[model samples]
Target: MLNRKIATSTAAVALLLTWSAGLTPAHAAPSSPAPTAAGWLARQLVDGERLETVVDQVPYPDQGATADAVLAFAAAGVAQDNATKATDWLARPQTLAAYLGDGTTESYAGAHAKLALVAQVQGRDPRSFGGVDLISRLTALQAPSGRFSDKSAYGDYSNGITQSLAVIALERHGTAPEAAVDYLVDAACQDGGFPLYLEQTPCASDADTTGYAAQALLASGRQAEAARALEWLEGVQGPGGGFRGSGPTPQENANSTGLAAQALRVGGRTAAADKAVAFLKSLQVGCGDAARAGAIAYDATGFDQGNATRATTQGITGIVGVGLLELSAHGEATAPASDCPITTTTTTTTTTAVPATTTTAGTSTSSEPAAAAPVTSNGTRQLARTGFEPGPALALGVLLIATGVLALLLARPRRAER
Candidate 1:
């Protein structure tokens, strides 16, 4: 009888263990046939809308004018001919260009790049849409050592993200591909990964930095280098096929994994690409989530990765470039322009004022009328901007929260008692 009771207890314990193992969350299986670029694009539209919405909320002194101009350009690109839209944006380019002027930083460059991309998609000539100016600014930002700067100071050299954007801009203009490639190569660390910036301090190469580097290399036609970077990334994948931002947090991050998958795909590594695709599919939030509707959540942040927020936008771009996500489906779809026109107009303005003080008693007071004001078009504005639906955001939020909680629980330590 005693032997039989012991056997029964052991059997029950074994059965429970087996059931628990089977109940563990499985890796996200790939959804259907692989998602196409257009499909992925449709999934990733939140980043663009989010960007516009965030910028709209900020209280910059020039916010109104800049927003007006950007929205106009974006709307015109969809409604009017690409050239006409480009002309409208370029006419008031100074509004946004001010952000790119001297003492400008990464955020400015990134904002302009995002705007440029919108113009690109709208079929504007890269040169006419301020792409050339952006290239010049980014080039100047590059240090002599080939690293992009965190600021004007050469001390902080985290060139991966900046270099990635520069590569996009360079490719757009059909110039400086070699320079962009060289910048990416120089920023690479010994471990085949990249750091946020180049510092003397010891820091592990990160998924975000590596993802940007991989994308840049791929864009510049250096598939081999991009492939090597992807190999390095494979080493960093966590237990459940998600990626960590760095050492402190081992959580499986949706955004990082999505971006990593994109890089791998673009680098031409099908095996890793498949894993990344699976991971992203698992993290997809449904359309009703709070932060973003109908888009992939960035991580457990409950925020859509690609919307107007800076980090999210970069992540979205990476994913989109790799063909894993798509933009929203509701926006107006216009045909690409057949012809790009060249239109130029110039105006001169002058003002004269009498001296407030009479240092010279003999000097005569002179009055002059202001020169003729420049004539300009009202430019294109969005008849209706796209809005996010609730279902996608809710679904993405649910996934993000669930995964984040799981990661936290897994990371927790069990108590030891005396």
Candidate 2:
């Protein structure tokens, strides 16, 4: 059970113009003349009035992406009605909370955390959304080391996001997260950007994990660490003001740029944030395809060769600097992390503990975590997470923003979409 009280204090939604004022960098990046992201997104709704992965693929609404779209609307101060519909779709029991990973303890940690944050920003009960208690479920999945993923899934897929989203969701519920920040702090690469998992050795850092980790630390009030991370993360930005995905590929894209942009904005790097926003805007699908005009692309070529649904929704998050840390600023006193450990531990002898096991979000255990799924050789495995392909590919898939980057790199869209 969640050792916290869910809060429901409603604040009048602010207009989009000033939505990012608080997070705007001291040195704003070069601004651009762009369409209203919220209004553009609002036009892509399907007949059900909910945001779909592609409006044609999967047919059903994407709960996680829908939550992201709602938060984006809230951030932009437009399309409250459509945002409301997306929220309603997520709040349905048969949707995000109920169907993702089919109730697995680990599979949908990111989705649940993000959905709870949507409720948090709306001043609703994230714990009792559609009779599903996301806070409690997320809390129950914490591992002994304070990580949130199970071992059975792919690499850092669940843990990194679990840590990031948990900080925000639990705060809205008025309960301090019991997981120690040490796990995320330890996950940082030498460059200060965090990896998909924890590590002690030198490894390359990634924008996605680094962005989420920075946001998680900020929401948790670990400002010093957040500051250091923001610096290292800024180093990865390319000349075009975009950040790269995890791995050997230094290519810039919306998902990574969005994540890094949100992190930089909240962490007090306005110039970096502004530049990232500009880069993402340049990726929006425009003029050519009327059906996808307002949608965001995964990367430069995505507009011509990729699907826009997931990338567009997530892209809006970075563009507006929408995050739980920002939301926490509006509510009453934010929830602090609990002192006692929140992860579960079984009785095992010290000797047997040598080959000791560690658990992840889905209750799956691993013999050796490859010494944490950092940017080492094991890093490649981090890109193979199953379920919910995101990014450039337009596949008929379910939900999992464990970042769509992995999907973009590994899977090709097999089915054709309208």
Candidate 3:
């Protein structure tokens, strides 16, 4: 009787163990949601629209007005690669001054910088429009500690908007300004993200600040540091294939995503770069009127009703143009036809001008015209263009590293508590 009772108990225990094993699979964690194209599309629309509005309203000239018209046309030409139109616009001094005069000193400086970029691309001397002087003023705006202060009192230091603008100015003027990078790096928090300025800073790194920082650094020639900042950026990307400005908000906005993608691409993260491109494409509303299509609206579905501005227009144009350029360079985007011109307008004149000399790393090269020459270093060639550079990237990277280390250290105690 005892042996029989023991056998039954053993069988009962085996049955219970089998039942528990069966329940384990059901209690397992849920799988991560797959990334959706729609989510990416939504982010693009918001960013595209905001960018479009900014580009549209910045007071481009009426068609017949020589000066403003020229600037207006030039601005449009840069977007569309219309060299003929750009030249026509540049041919008129009054229009140029009018367009250049629309903003305060800061905005004018930005306009000149943009013009200088277009000139650089067309193999023209950027200094013709007082580009160097403009850069100097932009640089002068920088505080002794390397931080930039907007002349406007209402400007928020935390946004780092002026600094970003300064980065563009410095880049177009053909030199990487280290002061901005130093200031930004000094202000970096313990996290891989930057606070707007240095106070009332966001809890997590902001997408806008991070994106701008990444651009500045990459343009300045600090690839390794840019890569580090990008790695930190990777952590901020939402599952939706878009990044949030901060916190739990997952609104997939365009400005952040567009800028972020550009930064990642410049930093050499091909996969993430592809994802960002896909996201931007998903946001495209197809070519239509400024109100209907050219404007990058709030969602891929096209619901936002905001007015267009020059800033958005330039941002979109730069992203699409530069993004395509980068992709084409890597053979990811289609190669342009031999007859295809990067600029949209046709040139009426064929002037083979003398080449200007340039000094890089204290070494001067005189093989080609300054406009047509390529500055090569470490297997990377840079055309004289108004963009971000490596100095900011290095500074941003230093900050990111410091922030990441702090985050890890702080996380240790939390894990221990748990």
Query: How far is each candidate from the true structure, as Cα RMSD in Å?
Result: 27.2, 29.3, 25.5
Candidate 2, pairs of clashing residues: 25-270, 106-361, 106-362, 149-360, 149-361, 150-360, 150-361, 390-404
Cα displacement (Å) at residue 350, model 3: 60
- What stretches of model 1 exceed 4 Å from their correct place? 1-99, 102-121, 130-132, 150-158, 175-180, 247-250, 287-293, 301-418
Best by TM-score: 2
lDDT, candidates in the order shown: 0.45, 0.58, 0.42
Compared with the true structure, what per-residue lDDT tens digits does model 3 show for residues 1-418?
Answer: 3333334443333333333222211111101000111111112232121111233556333321121211222322322223334434553566455445423542343344445444444445545643333444445556687766545434523245345545654665566567766665655556666554454535446776676676666666656555667887787776645655555434766556766766676666777766654454434332112122223333333324442222133224224424211221111111111111122221122221222322111112121111111211111222322223343455455555545554555445444334
TM-score of each model, in listed order: 0.51, 0.63, 0.49
Task: Give each model's clash number.
Answer: 37, 8, 43
Q: Best candidate, lDDT-wise?
A: 2
Question: Which of the two, 2 or 3, has more TM-score?
Answer: 2
162, model 1: CA deviation in Å?
0.4
Give the better candidate number (1 or 3) by TM-score: 1
